[model samples]
Target: MDSMKNKIKLLAVTHHDKKNINPIRPEASQIIGLHRSGEVDVLVLCNPGSILIPYFEKEGIEVLTDPLEKKLSISTVLNIRKLIKNRDVDVLHLFNNIACSNGATAAIGTRCKVIAYRGQTGNVSRWDPSCYLVMLHPRLNKIICVAKAVENDLRKYLWGDKSRATTVYKGHDQSWYQNESADLSDLPIHDDSFKISLVANLRPRKGLHVLMDALALMPEGINIDVLLVGADSNNEKIKEMIQRSTIPKRVHAMGYREDAPEVAAASDVIILPTTKREGLCRAVLEANSYGVPAIVSDTGGNAELVENGISGIVVEPGNPKELADAIVQLYKDRAQCKEFGVNAKRRAVTKFNVEQGVDATIKIYKELTK
Candidate 1:
């Protein structure tokens, strides 16, 4: 461990503006731990309007505000370079595609080690010039992957030294998930029905339509309902699909609730049917932490969090029949659902502990600083 006599200086840039900060809470645990370690002096650069400013400032870390919108902004690069020179920063940690590109460019000719974060799969292509500026950039000292699957995808296109990419899951603690479930009485869902949740922003890749397809295929009187709890869940596509589905009344689309976790926690099981490019699906992690089994599509790292027939079920993406069958399997056997929930909760505790992620991060920082 580095002594108080010498502390590593860390400068991080990220795009948190207009994005929900709740998803970044796990990263907050890592950041706060690094600053409080007495071995790292941390400074963050984010958008002026970002809620992350107040959250980090509350913990006494310095935060600078800049829109940081463009990838090749000379002013942004020079501004970052100035901060590095003034503070003698030892490392630059980037949390977004633009940040990774700009931060790496800004650190040019400097001794500062660059660390870029990769949260999703795909998009790192050798043919793409922007890819060279982002993940394929040679200036990056390290790429912190959110999952092993992300690292695997990265190595397929990244240039020399595959070891430069590392897996460091943005882990969570069960304590953070231990909260009172939201009272769902207002919803049309019955008390005795087996509740299911699919918590994601209704992006086309999220496969909300596929989920609706599965609901339509469900046999009559399945006694199960789905809770759609994310932004745009009530979008036109979803609305049209719900109207066509047999279980239209059973599907309650609660668009973007602040109490999403509480609502999801109230479910017997959760589903993540996203088609592709997922990186450790935070929804699945959240559900597992909530002690609710997840039935996730086998895309990206969804399977990493679930063991088939153990913690939860893993079905192929866009396969409504398989998904419907899995849901029915869990619903028909409450004992099996309870068993899977126990395993899922245990898996979250054993594999996704936030302190372990922090420890690995600090170790990496120490190595680079040393």
Candidate 2:
């Protein structure tokens, strides 16, 4: 308490997804960054079994083992209320919808400031009563959006001062993606084939069907192979889509692999053909971090991540022909593909690095605390 007296007190509560820490790490790491910065006394509330628990302990961060109850759990709210009062918390930073709702409720009648983290776009409406419990709540001091797309979407429904919502991209260190690419020989992809990887669940919004459309449209003997990672890749519908496509054998759907980064690293290029409401695709970021070029649809913040014609290609969403054409451009020019890879990696390190995000988070804290 003596050591922390001069610093801002930050309490961040979020569930650490055990399946993949990549998406959640940026949020977690910034808390560590704030602690390291010596400007904030950080506390974390997460699952007890989180892989990050050891790291939190190592850093001597005060840890609380509760995800803070999802959506108005009474005990969770009371715990948060008690922590705000007892810890003299300055900033209550909540990640995810459940935390935002519960954390805001706890902040009522308290002097503590609250910040809500928005990771995606849509699924919110001013007309929706549930949204009022979360995003449209009047008590929030700020809304930390993970991308410009998310900020814009959220601003559409904010009943309070719209300026409270700000876009600050969740960033990553390139070092986290430096793993040796896994062996691809186990799969049917040929040695000479141009590998294109995608690391999202096979779903409509993810646009697996649209990506399949482009693959089917590729001319015969193009030597392109697709690597599909994440869940539901082996489901009957996905299998049927592949079976019916022209490049039936070329698409390999590997469901939820621990070695996903390694698999993506082995690829010649990455693609996210997401159709709508994407905040930012972490798969594209992972590939870019690995010095792999990407071809993403022009939906949401895809364009922000991939600098079109420099780092990678951006095509109109749901347009299989444009996606196919973009793929062909990269396919025909291996040199250009490699160049894009270099630029992609450079973009990640220069603009979207973790330090910048941490600084942005600190700026928000300073403003709220002042």
Show where candidate 2 strays beyond 4 Å: 1-3, 67-69, 231-234
| lDDT by residue (tens digit), candidate 1, 55-90 | 789999999977788987888899899998998999
TM-score of each: 0.95, 0.96
The residue pairs found clashing in candidate 1 are: none
Best by TM-score: 2
Superposed model 1: Cα runs more than 4 Å off = 1-5, 200-202, 231-234
lDDT of 1 at 113: 95
lDDT by residue (1-370, candidate 2, tens digit) is 5876879998888766576677567766777888899989998877667777777879989889875546888888898899999999999998877888888999999999999988778888868888877888888999998889888888888875899999888778877887899788878887688998887565589988888888888887899888888746548887887775578788888787887778878999988898898887777888888899899988888989999999999999999999999999999999999999999999988988889998999998998889
Worst window of 10 by summed lDDT in candidate 2: 15-24
Per-residue lDDT value at 135 in model 1 = 93
